[model samples]
Target chain A: MAGSGSDDDAFVFPVRTHFHAMARRPGGIPREQAIEAAESHLHELHHEFKEWLDQELAEIAKILPQSADEVTSDDPWVEAAHARCQAVRDTAATMGFYLVTFAANNLCEAFDTIRSGIEYPLDAIDRDFKTLLLARQEADSADRTRLQELIRRMENPSAALPPAARRTPSK
Target chain B: MTRENLNLHGINFLVADANAYFCMISQSILRSFGATKIYEARNAMDVRRALVEQRIDFLLCDSMLPPSGGLELTRTIRWSANSEYRTIPILILTSDTRLNTIAMARDSGANMVVAKPVSVSGLYNRIAWVAFHPRSFVDSPTYFGPDRRFKIEGFPTGVGRRKGDKEFSVGEEDGPALAQDDIDSLLNLARKA
Candidate 1:
């Protein structure tokens, strides 16, 4: 079920395949099998990550939304969404989709903490779920701008990143 | 928004900066603009490491690559490096706009030079225009814009009137546009992305 569920995620976030295709372009990829190179690698990513995300999605779909208007505070689906996004983010980072990986990491830090925390009582699970949904929605709303910035940087190295948000990896 | 690494293999964009919010927003926008992969590299050394490690299609370089000036770095890449790595198009953004400095920048091998501080909208269009329409663009010319000491108008042949239409066509003297390939690179880089 999880395997099939990630297909939905694969459909929405297709970074893995995009990266694979680029890597295989030139100065990369094996000498042999260059013939079917593009197709095979891209397809492989779609199958692996997307399928896993699809499964995660299926879990969310199953758990959340008791009825169109009846998603209660205790909805288990919200937790699933948070977890799925966490895993997806980790996977996206490995594949080289900067924005997706960053976003996924964002989701993990935001939702996963609350999900795992003992601070939120069992009775108030609804509040936690609401917070998760709200945060996710905010990120979703900003997706267009975020991704556009990502594209600009992709096209040219000299494009500026907002100075306030820039980070340096440690030595 | 936070992005995650996926299992699939493909292109990744790397943002080389130390500011966190700046990285987040820029990385996010880059994707919306059409990049599938994005990475972050802060400072000059990070940029070098990223270039060596990843198959970066694009880079978001800070004009202020601490310790060393970004302008100087562009010059090194242009003059010293071999073609394979040198092929990457670098867009240099500088805060100061001294005419002489801009001229030196052109010679340094920067594909395009943008004045800073750039508005987000301007940044978006500039990167998209250059990255998406690469073939149409070429090298940025050694333009020495207006300054008291050195200016395009100060040229021996009153080139002030040579701006806009007066310069390119001159009443149907149909030769190659501008007679300089570098200017074409600027026009193309600044063209609609």
Candidate 2:
């Protein structure tokens, strides 16, 4: 459990100022309870967002092509996939899942550019989705750091990956 | 006021969020802050029904409600002929912090926009700011909401009254009116969502 006094001050968040201010008000909520509640919400979001991501990825599998040249931006299935991708971005951002949020954002931006008649690598989106799922399972800082490095390597494939981190893209 | 001193005896709150966990957590935070009679709405229709059926004082809404979402709901509450809560304080809580999203929130008549995963103090301060020390409401041809200006005399260089352009204030009665196209551009951004 994250103690209110320790966890609140440890994180450098701008909103904590607001929380402290409200906590001082004559009839405001306590800082400890608020932190606890927020932590609980984050736990639930992790589970729920994981389920949502799986469903979205399943849907994307049915529509997305193995190559970039086969689809247009206006296709109904593509549009639907974009919507789900956006939902993932928004929800992950809300939960403070920074890696998933970052990957989803880039994927959306790539799609937007592709829709505007720009030719780009479609494999990047799949790689980003895979990275999002990998980041989801990372529960520690070292694991997260390694995953971040893998994302970087995936982006710049010229960079070599360690033997333990190398893998084939399943989709 | 301290935690024990905080007194929300008669204040009624409505929290509109599609996420059940978020709703529950927000309610818990409010209750800890001494608030009672907090209502939850999961969708836009439930929000409308809650407004019509209850005497709601403050509204905390998520930006991504189903159907049309919260920005459209803000427009409806602000401009609807049948709404009695046009002047009620609305605070948008969401994780979408795109520049266009913030602009739409301002243009749609929201009192404040707080990013999600907010701290208790952050939520409380915004609610207190809205409830007690609100900015003057503005009803322009293309916009209707609390004044977007947070600073009175802190415009960046060359932007406002620099080089002695003119000394003036943007009160409820006097300000530069936004063009229709500018407003349309923002609404268009919301549509892209």
Candidate 3:
């Protein structure tokens, strides 16, 4: 919803038709139909969330290089990066995508830790920045696995899947 | 109980919400206890990490924060040895009154939850009560309503009329319902109920 125009509009339409149509149907689309609808909407939401994550991570990766080298430029773009990262986090949480959420959350913490290390001492910020960059890289790598797991979750919300380390303690 | 021995030295507390108003409200609630040391984090991770690395006593955590919610932070603090920053009492401050949010907050390791439009007395009652009995819910012993702060703890709690200034009847425990003849008073209390 932050960016402009009709793309956001598309997220609402087809699912909405199914929603309204289901609402008016005889006795609300039977048990099987209800399950079908739930699965349908969840899949849509999952895909939508993944698309958003992919776009944001790509944008962040692009920004890292641009901002990393320019010493005079915002000397600290960490806060802004965090602000953008926070937006990604909130969306993941609201969507109940905890794996992605967990990674994003930890990544943000690392960014803050490095940013806070900015003191009169010269190399602290740079050292922190390097640590933060590693964290970002690790998160980018983890996103693929999380995205696949999330897609699987959409297919069967109740599936008792094998416990992956990434899923547990996703708090 | 009373604002007695709660003053600790000049501890600086920081709050870092992108929302200035929410941060201001949190600052005011923390300041009420005369605790000069308070800090705010823009989100959970920053605050949690700083709490471990610094010296902070009471933490007021927001349940719905960006990146990760406060629960994740609480877990990290409680479980990780590197973050054993004492069993610092944490009171989760949230505007969300939803059952799921409350459950989520507790899941995150909050000792208690405070609903928002945060009130000073509510904040005080919650903080003191939690600090007094950390990890256990304290049943509020007195009824808080419009006219007075009275009790139903035993021996005809309210006096025969308003016996001048006050009198203490220190026996038994009585329920909220008394004579309906005091229906106005009863209704007043009932309205709150």
Candidate 4:
């Protein structure tokens, strides 16, 4: 424990320097060698990563509403989907799947906007979900870029529409 | 001032996350750093159990841990008057690196916020930094954790706002201000020390 006085009293506790001694002990592996070993382990886990990603996508699909009519502005499913996407985003990048991470991050943002009371387009959500699936299937960077551009447009449809055809009125 | 390679052997680490894959990945990274003992926790209950059973040297927690988030767990640990684990080094792992999110993690008593998907080098450096540079814990009325301020060059007005802060007078300048390169070199020296 850091301190031993009353809760109301402000105090400063000294640093614990034991870790320094532990880290500096002899016979430790070299930094580069340890990193190389870890990278090898991650490579071995790549197959498992695909299986994990598949399970995560399936869970997201199961939790999200099937149709726009089924979703309300404050639907709890939206939050659930957001959390699932966040998990995917956090893991995909570490597994060397940057495109999947990007698509998942996009969906996470859309859910965040929806949760904040904005009326996000359900079609955009569907497209992002599809993009995630496609990104997992396709490894081409050009295709990934194209899919990301499409999702960006879907995220903000009014940006693609002309001034006279905008959906929400500009302030 | 030379840095030594980190040896995490014999250190007990607790990795808490709702996602099992994330926990596995974190474990892999820690193992790469020579960690031999690691525990996994999926929720608050698991975390509490692990804290009670193990003498955890480090904690890597997901920002959105289930059934009451990681921040809540951190606050509970920090506010617990009698808990021996109150001052454990907590590193929050999350993909959300927005400014507000980082600020919230800091306010919740975490020592560091690591953005995901975590790279091997990034994780290694963060762990080494925390181990090498231990911060003094500050016990205040509204806060109980590592001191939020990283550096204390001086307050803006040569005074602090805290109740116990002391007022100091600025000394008259005796020489010309150092050049930018000179300042940078000085800081680099200090960091190396």
Candidate 5:
């Protein structure tokens, strides 16, 4: 609704309250009460994130090729997969799922690189998606350490990546 | 030791989140904190309508609303000609972790920028901090809303200052803080025509 105006609507929404006559809230919320209130909301979001991740993973699986060499930037499948990766990146970042967000970001970048005719190793793309899935599963299981490791791997996958996964897909 | 419970007995809140789940979460949390009236808006348009119809005490807005999103919303409210709407505290909630994104939130006149999935403790902490330590809003030619700069530990020379640089700590010259009377009158002024 933000851009709904004609670019010159000086006044859109207006309210006339006796602001000077109204009493402000008593004071700042106590720390304990604040935490208790926040926990309830965050708990719901945590479960919601888990459910969203599951759905995203299922969607990702349907689009992934059996082999990295099958990737084609112009292919509709590639575009769909890239779009999914972007959505995952945005949503996962919101939930503070570090590994998933990072991997998804790289996955988008890899797709972009491929689209630009760069020969980024297709195996790297495959591994990135695999890493993202692993992170999602680990997050579901509350494996915080593994999530951190996946984040590290996403930051520098080539260092710990197996030799086979470092190979480029044949054009 | 003294303990005080957070009491939102009569507070009215407007939550603007594009996601239905997020709206539910924010509303639930606000209720827990003792808010008596909580309004939900799924997009920028609804947000405007809610503002027009309700006497909101606080606002929790998502940065990814639709069409224009929270950034634009913040600008609209902050620059509104109406004093009652302009001074209402706004919290920009989003998942954007990029520094530039946070900077954009600050530039948009948000009272605070909070990252999601926001936890109970994090949300409360920000609310309490903002409530008790409200920053002086500045309406400059190029900027509006709460002052963006805050002091950081060990940054003695101030932001971007070298160790030998002679600039005093930023904000030291603001003098004694504005009195309640001064603040009230200052906030009542319109920044734009």
Candidate 6:
């Protein structure tokens, strides 16, 4: 009886209360205990996380255009690469790969801008790919911060750069 | 907001994502919360099959699910005329938290949109929120889904946009401003549930 109503009027379906009954059952573990267990499970899978991340990165690399001429917003490969970047963004942080998450997020934003008809420079995308590779190799916080700044510049080209960065001549 | 334990033992969950590792991560979190019957699907076709085969109580779907996307799948489920699962709660998980994407998910009838790189606490809180705060499904000409309006503190500009909306006078501000903790507690009350 949920969707049976006149199109001109709004019909309200009554709330389903069964979930409350099911979730409030007896013998539930403490909230902290549940979180700890889940975290432990994730930690146990840390070994596999590296392999998974590598595979995802390889897939993204494989799908990326080899040249600016090969890049097309409408291409299925572009979308595929974007989705893989999203997957890395979504899972990396949970496994303690915050730098990887950061780089993937930057790549996803770049992809979003490109999909919206903006003409993002190919060098920016290539730099993001390199940043991802560097993030995988470097775990130091200082190094991560430096990489993040590099991505920030790539994402916002017109923004004022640091004195040291500005002093360096354009490639 | 005091944390309350969740018992998801009897609640069946279907997690649909193209990434196998992501699916495994979701399953691990759900299992830790006491869920026993968790199903996995990698595409829209698999999702439909799971919905038909399993008595799914909840769905955690990736926004970029392959073939037909998650939003499309959600709309299909919402508009399905003969399916009991049409009204099941859906929570879309995504890394893209853009306003447009969130609006699309809402318009597609999802109960909630959870941002990804999901922390255990965040995931638990969202699941609890969806379970405890059930919204009334709206069946209108243009939309067939949960009422998109999450709050009814009278529309801004003191006017309603819809034809049937009732006109109401705006009341004067009352009482002192709430502290940040109070606001957080109110927003995260489901964590206590």
Report iRMS values in order.
18.8, 13.6, 27.6, 6.1, 8.9, 6.1
Which runs in model 4 stand beyond 4 Å of their true positions?
A: A1-9, A17-20, A69-73, A139-171, B151-193
Pairwise lDDT winner, candidates 1 and 4: 4
> All predictions: root-mean-square deviation over Cα?
21.9, 12.4, 24.0, 10.8, 10.1, 10.4
Error of 4 at B95 (Å): 3.1
Q: State iRMS for model 6.
A: 6.1
Candidates ranked by TM-score: 4, 6, 2, 5, 1, 3
Better of 2 and 5 by lDDT: 5
List residue ranges in candidate 5 displaced over 4 A.
A1-29, A44-49, A57-126, A139-171, B1-5, B152-193
The DockQ leader among the candidates is 6
Tens-place lDDT per residue, model 2, B4-89, is 33345557789998766567667766775667789999999999999889888778998888779899999889887456687677
Among incorrect, acceptable, medium and high, the docking class of model 6 is acceptable
**Weakest ten-residue segment in model 3 chain A by summed lDDT:** A10-19
Model 1 lDDT tens row, B61-155? 55555547676666555444353445455666554365655655555555556664444334544543343233221222332111112112221
Cα lDDT of model 5 by residue, A71-111, tens digit: 55666677677756766776666456777777778788888
Residues B121-163, candidate 6: write the lDDT tens digits: 7787777776655677777555677766565432223222366
- How would you class the docking of model 4? acceptable
How do the residues B1-89 of candidate 4 rate in per-residue lDDT, one tens digit apiece?
Answer: 24467788988899999888888998997898899999999998999999898888788998888888888899999899898778888
Report lDDT per candidate.
0.45, 0.64, 0.47, 0.77, 0.67, 0.77
Q: Report the C-alpha lDDT of model 5 over B1-193, residue by residue, as the tens digit.
A: 2343445666678888866656776776777666668899989999888888887878899887776989998998888756567867789987665676777787788878888657655676566555544565665445557765553232211222356755434545655444433533454342221
Flag regions of model 6 displaced more than 4 Å: A1-8, A69-76, A139-171, B1-3, B151-193
TM-score of candidate 4 chain A against the true chain A: 0.71
Arranged by DockQ with the best first, the candidates are 6, 4, 5, 2, 1, 3
Candidate 1 chain B, run of 10 with poorest lDDT: B143-152
Candidate 3: list runs displaced more than 4 Å. A1-171, B1-5, B8-18, B136-193
Better of 2 and 3 by lDDT: 2
Number of backbone collisions per candidate, in order?
75, 13, 13, 0, 2, 0
Q: Estimate TM-scores for all models.
A: 0.36, 0.62, 0.36, 0.76, 0.61, 0.76
